[model samples]
Target: MDRGKKPTTFFANRNNKIYMDLKDIIRENTLRYLPAKSLRRCTSVCREWKLYISTPFFAHNQSNSFHDLSGFFCQSHSSQPSFISLDPIAYGVPDPSLKFLPEPVDIRCSSNGLLCCQGRTGYKAYYICNPVIQQWKKLPKPDANHGCDPALVLVFEPSLLNFVADYKLICAFQSDLDGYEFDIYSSAEGSWRTSGEICFGNRQIVPSTGVHVDGIVYWQSRSTVVAFDLTSERSTLIYSYSSGSLGKVNGKLCSASIQGSKLTIAELSNPYTNTMQMHSKTRAWSVKNVTLNDSVFAGQTDQKSVLFIGGKIVVIRLGSTLISYDTRTNDIKQLATEVDYDPRMIPYVNSLVEV
Candidate 1:
């Protein structure tokens, strides 16, 4: 070795290997914490990084850590939809305009940050999109070609099966006869398949939005509850005295009915039983009553819509005024008032859910 300069001898190869391992660990943690938008841009960084971020496990973990209510998707009278951020402190900027939706589309339903929309004038187009990420996919039209309006439900849960790429879109409509039929579109299958037909006898499937509980979907009819098992592809009708307005309250399937100014909530409960049940015992529903203040019921002649917006907060919409009733503290908060139309507000949480 020369006296003036040091030779090329450095740290051992084992030390360099350890340093690279630490670098990889740090990179993974950093990628996991990044928001969905940034992580999507990072996919083009390198081949290895792209593969890692696209994996189901990585998407699942990122979704679990990044769970938060981004905002509400509001549809105005002009049939144009916009996203209003719920947290003004975090996203105080102007409301984001939705450019992904078609010009004249009907805003149907939303679940787990995904919106299910259909074309107003045609039956060929159906879309599932995430307004936050501006990502959308057009669904293949169902096999049945009917003109009846279909009830739509969108279900997307990233934490299930450690995958964020799976989703289910269900469409139920009245058949030509006096019965109801369903068509389910699965991302795994990439096609729409018709499910079993359910004859309502004399009763009809009262038009209402579907409420998802666990993995099953429930719809309230006149005097019964239609429960669709997404896993088994079966439909069950349970007799219920609910008001045809169904929602999930405190993580349980609940039904709400408004009588005068009193709002009644009933939850379906399954109790432990040791004996063999006869004819598939029906689950019991416990009832709780909450009286709405005069302000909520003032100048409201039309029927009110009730929805549970997670965390014990019940949203009541009567005409143009939107009121939120907190079940925990018994406090009522007015969210918004005087809108262009009756806002179809859905409980939404932003995630990196790929449809």
Candidate 2:
């Protein structure tokens, strides 16, 4: 070691200049195979590299469209969920607050960068809020009635590169055991239509969280996965697991959630295991299992919650610490918590968004 010179100065001097040839090569080669994790790490390597990577020209060429997108998770002690914008890049740490919509009572989203927030009024009234632009659009309710299911889902279709949203709301409700009726609303037409009665499904199993990927709303209904398409105006079945077999997973709903640029479903193995099974999006269910328990997942309820953020899988369980499963290294890392040995705020860990 050179006693006279400091380590920081030595490295900085050695890596100071920007090589145009090297930069061009990296910019070209990375467009086809740039790994998001590597890119983030590279940004911290040096200032010149960070500027090149952060440039709009280079960022546009990245493989995935939504590289750093965050899903907003809201929770509160009262009925109103504590509204906090979270950046999973910071691992559940609070980000800036959203000022566009009035205390959101309900919300649905789209891949084209739009989130529709419905205030306690249900389907009829909504505010289309774009997290990117930080703007809001209040729209009138649809005339048709769809029963009482107020579940909203956003669908992002990649092939079409089009964004669509679906509102699964119930316009009428009847007592007894006949069946609860509801209608699906569309963001394109701004109207509501009857989707017929869902007799086979459980009325009490409406999904609160959903991923809108590839033009379909992937929602978990108690034990089943119901996918509703906004373009086709049709509903299809993706998967239905046995009770306690696997829990829910969240993302913006698109093929990007799938590994290797393919569509896949990521969920827990069981209520007990700390392993997560990612079902590759294919005709034949090709499944890949990743164990995230390396001290990151431990305990009862804290090991089950999982959501796909950017290109990584984030696990947040009750009382457990927040951790992100890095697809780059195939490993899980514990994110810095607000405090040492701090119990995760109830619903706070769940309210993670990467916006």
Q: Pick by TM-score: which candidate is best? A: 1
C-alpha TM-score for every candidate: 0.73, 0.52
Q: What's the true lDDT of residue 336 in model 1?
A: 71
lDDT of 2: 0.42
lDDT of 1 at 162: 50
> Each model's C-alpha lDDT?
0.67, 0.42
Q: Write the per-residue lDDT of candidate 1 for residues 267-324, one digit (tens) a residue.
A: 7785222233866655467778887775657666866767444556667776676677
How many clashing residue pairs appear in each of the predictions shown?
0, 22
Error of 1 at 198 (Å): 2.7
Candidate 1 residues lying further than 4 Å off, grouped into runs, are: 1-60, 66-70, 76-78, 91-97, 146-148, 160-164, 259-261, 270-283, 292-311
Worst 10-residue lDDT window, candidate 1: 88-97
Error of 1 at 47 (Å): 20
Q: Which TM-score value belongs to model 2?
A: 0.52
